[model samples]
Target chain A: MGWTGRILAGAKFLAPLAVLLVLWPILIRAFNVNPQIFPDITAVARAGLESIRDGSLFAHMGASLARVAVGTVLAILVAVPLGVLMGVSPGVSAFLTPLLRFFSVLAGIAWIPIATLWFGYGFGAITFVIFNAVFFIVAYNTLLGVSTIPMQVRNAAASLGAGRWTMLAEVLLPGALPNIVTGVRTGLGFAWRGLIAAEIIATNIGLGYMIFVARDFYRTEVIVFGMIVIGALWLLIDRLLLAPVERATIERWGMVRSA
Target chain B: MKSLAIRNLSKTYFDAYAGAHVDAVRDVSLEVPEGEFVSIVGPSGCGKTTILNMVAGFIAPSSGEILVGDHAVAGPGPDRGVVFQSFALFPWKTVLENVAFGPKMRGVGKPERERIAREFLSLAGLSHAAERYPNELSGGMQQRVGVARALANEPDVLLMDEPFASVDAQTRMTLQEELTRIWQERRSTVLFITHDVPEAVFLANRVVVLSKGRVLEEVDIPLPRPRRWDALVESDDFKALANQVLQLVRSA
Candidate 1:
């Protein structure tokens, strides 16, 4: 679609959120809710402005985004090649499938407890949790993706003089890209939740910690503002980033099934 | 172009359903000389594909040697390019990229490989669709790319296994005619496999009929070059050659 068309679609998507924003303060005023219990829109906006002015919002956001970027990047780097190896060899896949399933089942926030014990609090522990959340899902999906490539296609590549590395780069990687992107989307979802949980328990600076700390002061505006930032950030990442990657790979390739 | 020689080729595999070993191909030997088109026709269970698979080095024979020129074939390589029944074009790659894959593998520069790709695509009558992906094309168009991909490699031998089997009859005929036209222009040594009798007879210089995993008969086709479905479909010579091969296939 053209730039204008995309902008129109983006505006349409955000309209519902805009309506909710408009309704939030109206309903809070109508109900006459106490500020201690729930913050009104203006109070939340004021809290957001205060945080921004103090640079605390940017600090927290930067910390969280860095941890997420490092953890997810490391997880993907290790996962995809391991997954492709497992996919290429049935013996390897069979042996690892059970272990992979077990870890995948135990992924995300569940790892936070031990991760804290192993790495202690703060960046290392929280990063480990985020990594746990992304690694298993992406690896499993990569395996699925690689294995799903048709045998005839492999043969064709081979006969056309594709060597080991060439086959992996030209044939296997592109073939598995759609599923890999899907895995990334789902894995990132889990990573975000795990990050928030880990941050609340471990880190002093982040959206989760900001919200958790506000509870002690009965600063419901700060808590609500932090929550809004968290949700909005996730929405932006999903819509602006992951959705376009999926469109480029899956939808463009016509690999998206009804299922 | 290099000649392909299959010596005492055989394949035996365990059949789990039957709980026994099944001899898929047995003691089959064939030769396609340089610049000649040879088609192997057979029934479904007669192991025509198995033999092709062996020659293409996708699978090893039970006991035999496959030679392309003086080089012994042990595994799939650029020397023996294959066009599968499924068309087997890389779904993610554009038609140009798919056709350019071989030269890219051979370490040709981007500009030269793309030039080769465009040349082959034009030869296949698909230059207009160069930037399109395989899924965007019809089955016939896909097979055309498949053929172009193999041909662009300039392999010593071009292996085709029922390359037009999935398309409609009309498209298949058109593909056959196009193939003959391309082969006439650039005579790469070819090994075509199919269950279709007329396809075997129409496309090959000689038709090798197979039954029960062995050579049933090898019928020579002295039919004129530049053969087309429109002119040859009803001609006595084409019918006689097709009928002769069909009877041999049915007799088994």
Candidate 2:
């Protein structure tokens, strides 16, 4: 991109955020809400300060991040290979697609009840929820990705002296990358929601638990503060990681038809 | 050694609902000698692509045989390279990587593969675009990478099925010239299929015209090489042959 384009893009991203910052004080004053029901900027700030001072914020954040990291990595490792294997044969793909879709539909927040029952309400249960959330969606997307690669391309690859393994590595995997990345983004989004929900219901620590615990004591400031942290964390991940990866794949692999 | 031989190669497709079998390519026989550039020009639906696909081992003949260097064709192998009409490049890979794919698949190590890929890239005049992915390059450049990839395998025969059909006329001319140059340098047996009469005349050592899924006639081009593009077009013989071939294609 040109310097002017880059600068304009940066400005566009920051403009709404700057406006939101400017409007914050007015919003707090106009609401006339109690500190216990809805925290003023100072109350939330003080809470944030207190949490940081006591190191509770770090501990919770670390636990949440660790769950996401472990769950997502495990899901990717299992889902991609299985999806590709199932996709190689049309009969297998046709047979398995409906089953996968059914499981993927049952992914995320819905898994909480069973996961808690199965793993007994702690890190294990939360991680299982996250893993199931990402796994089914990613596998479904990978299958779709591999299945949809143009047959002509596969024939072309084979005729150009590509063996079985080469066909899989060169044609199948790369062709499926855009869809796989898309699946990861969507799967991760569901997993994040499931994590939050699971933490609220089952875990003793983490951001969701923090909010739920605060709710019992009518600590609305803490709840509101936790919601902000969740939003900010998701924004950072999507913007900083997933969005760029998606953009790169689409731009690189998408066939642009000229008029 | 015979580069390629197809004996009574017949392929049938059954249309279940219609309760009739379609003979896509019926009893087609041809022998291509080593270092020959042969073009098969035919009408649409004359099973030109079906024949090419069978030779490439993408499909099997119902009752016939395909022999490459005395070995019966069972499946696609590295000995026969194919250039597809759509270019069919792996879009995610850079030009260098696409060209190197065949060598890499054959277990050639990185440094040697890169060096061989570089040679083919230069041969196709795409050395400058090595790092650029297929989507980023022009249609002409993408086809060039396809050619480079096919040649990198060092096959005994190169089968191109209307490789330039999707490109613009100007780009097609340049690619035709580049393909001719590559064929001359490597001397690989070529079985090229096209509907364009001029393209067949320009590139082939012998033009085998097909009509209604049969060989209508075979014309020895007798065009001398190293051929110059502008000069070949300006020649009276080239124009006459092109017209004769065009008439046959139109009639078919």
Candidate 3:
């Protein structure tokens, strides 16, 4: 869509959320709720301004974002190649799929105790949690992507004089790219959520720690402000980064029929 | 162009459902001289496709061998270019890139390969479609791209597996005439597999009718060059040959 069309769609999408924001203060006043129970919209806004002015919000956000970025990149670098290998070799995939499924079932948060014991608390532990969230899922998806390529296409490549490296580069990789992108998108979504939870237990400065510490002093406004920032950041990451990547792969390949 | 020869070729595999060995092709042999266009026409299950796959080295024969200028078939190679019925052009590639793929694999540099690819695309009447993706083209156009891709490799023998079977009748005729016109220029040895009798008579210098995995008979079309359905439609020679092949297929 063009700029004006995109802006209009953005406006339409935010309309309902704008209504909720307007209603929040009125509802708090009507109920005359205690500040400890839930902060008023104005109080939450003031707390958000204080954190920004003090630079604490930026510090927390930066740390969290860095961990996520490092962890996700590391996971992808390993996962994609491993998945392609598994896809090419059915025996290896069959042997490892059950093990992968078992580890995946143990969700990222479930690894916290062992992760801390192995790597100790802080960066090592938190990064391990994020890696766990992304790795198995991305690997599984990559395998699925590679296997879905038509056999005839591979045969065509071979008959065209493609050697092992050329076949992988020209046929296997591009053919499986759409599926690989989907895997990364989903895996990263989980990793983002897992990062927040891991940071609560494993780190001293991060979005999760920012909110969890507020509960100790009845700083309800700060807690609510942190929640909003967490939600908004995820929205930005998905919309600005992941969705475009997925769209590029699928649309560029004509993997999906155009509507 | 190189001659293609198949000797004592056979394929037999155990049918799981039948619990017995069933022969797919039985002791079949054939020869095509350099630059000859030969069509192998048969009904479904007559093993024409199986024989083509063996010659193209997609599958191994149970016995005997196939030779392309005295080199025995091993596996799929750049020496034998195949055109699939599905017109298996890479969807991710533009028309130019798809045609360039074979040369690219052979270590041809970018400018030289693109030049070669463009030459073949124009030969196939698809120069205007160089930047378009395969999915954007009609079925007939995609098949043309397939032909262009195979020819760009300049293989010793071209193997086509029902390349026009899925196209609509009107478009099929255009593609057939186009094939003949290109063949006249390139003169690549080709073994085309198809079920349609008139198409067999329309494109080939010689037609080999096959049934039950063996050769039924062979017929030659002395029809003059620059063959067109429009002109050949009225000729008694074309009808008699098509009828003769049709009868052989029916008898099998």
Candidate 4:
């Protein structure tokens, strides 16, 4: 709760990773594993440093992050309002629920082949995959969130003289925010994974591409380094960005047990 | 201040699947005079909440009309404020912001709204928690905020649907006393719904008892003003009034 307490808690999270790092080298020596199968810890570290020195690591990470950002932002901008619109009407929401569910299930990796065909295997195709991954889930979740607001709250707002616009702004939006933020977090997760898969299949740049290309040349060290970079990047994004946003929304809007 | 008049009001629900008609409230008529505190007490299925909701314009009567002042109630509007049993405070908003919501909806300026919110929050004894979100507060505190939010709208009539029913007994008592204090100062016409006989007797000038979707009795409370819960509950007059209503409900 305090600054020092938070710092200590953050350090506690690293304990498992620290143990894994320590075990990694010992396991490498004990097994006498072929380098082709798995690179040594030092080899992976050197590969990481080499990529960083050449600036390719930053370029790949930037490309991956940028695509996710652009695609997710665009998806959210379109999905949230549309979701709210559809959700406000029970008839519309009921009619569209099954359709949204179907599309959400078919999102992300399933769209990669069609997206590549449509956009000709480049940034456009990869961005499309990420967009597809984020869009349906966010929209469906937004619909769920908006529809779940208790009628009593809306009535309370209306009785207090909230007009259509006022109710939407003050009651509907704020009430549904906890759900919307959750949708964004989930959508981003799917989109992040989709972005990696799309990059591997279609794009010439990004963390996925870096690792996939390494596999062909027997560059297991580079592949391992890329995997670490991907994992670290995801952890940072989830912990620093999405998780905090989700936690704050839930804390602010959640039905907390009374103390 | 304007009185609330319910004229031959009725609500019937058609259960399509069951192929049956349910009369939630039947030919209910009552008058809550301006600045009067009226409580509707009833058994579980007596539709006390239906009457409250109708007055609040959340539900339309199948027949007859509800009038606040000279205006026939059309729909829910700022002229009437409702306090729900669940508190219904916006979880995302801070205490001050929740209180300010009504005034803000009515296009009050930001500074004026804040001042109005502060005044009501202080009246509710929640000024100390102005910045705290609804979820952070105790049930009583959140209900206090709910009271402030309703009052902040400056409605002609205050409609409360069992507002204190959800809280613990101790908190409910405190809230009842606090509500009486606030009502004494503001002199707003109030229609409070509750199942608890003692609560009805404690808060209302007149306690209306309902049974089977109909008015069973409306007993007047002659208890003196500035009533304290501890002292009032033990008094012979309070007990008599509560017992009378309790008997009506139990018999029905």
Top lDDT model: 1
lDDT on C-alpha atoms for all candidate structures: 0.92, 0.87, 0.92, 0.89
Every prediction: chain A TM-score = 0.94, 0.91, 0.95, 0.94
Q: Which ten residues in a row have the lowest lDDT in candidate 1 chain B?
A: B225-234
Tens digits of per-residue lDDT for model 3 on A101-181?
A: 776556788888999999987988988888988888888878888888887788888889998889889988898899888
CA error at residue B92 for candidate 2, angstroms: 1.9
Using all chains and alpha carbons, the TM-scores for the candidates as numbered come to 0.97, 0.93, 0.96, 0.93
Pick the winner on DockQ between candidates 3 and 4.
Answer: 3
lDDT of 1 by residue, A120-148 (tens): 98999988988877899889989999999
Top model number, TM-score: 1
Each candidate's DockQ: 0.86, 0.70, 0.82, 0.79
Query: What is the Å distance of residue A158 in model 3 from its true position?
Result: 0.9
Q: Name the 10 consecutive residues with the lowest summed lDDT in model 1 chain A.
A: A250-259
lDDT tens digits by residue: candidate 3, B69-90: 9999999999999999988888
How is the predicted docking of candidate 2 categorized under the CAPRI scheme? Answer: medium
Please give, for residues B1-49, the per-residue lDDT of candidate 1 as tens digits: 8999999999999999999999999999999999999999999999999
The fraction of correct interface contacts reproduced by each prediction comes to: 0.90, 0.76, 0.76, 0.92
Q: Report the TM-score of the second chain of model 1 against its true counterpart.
A: 0.99
Per lDDT, what order, best first? Answer: 1, 3, 4, 2
List, residue by residue over B84-129, the lDDT tens digit for candidate 2. Answer: 8888888888889889988888889999999999999999999999
Give me candidate 2's TM-score against the actual structure. 0.93
Model 4: pairs clashing at backbone N, Cα or C within 3 Å: none
CAPRI accuracy category, model 1: high
Clashing pairs in 1: none
For model 4, fnat equals: 0.92
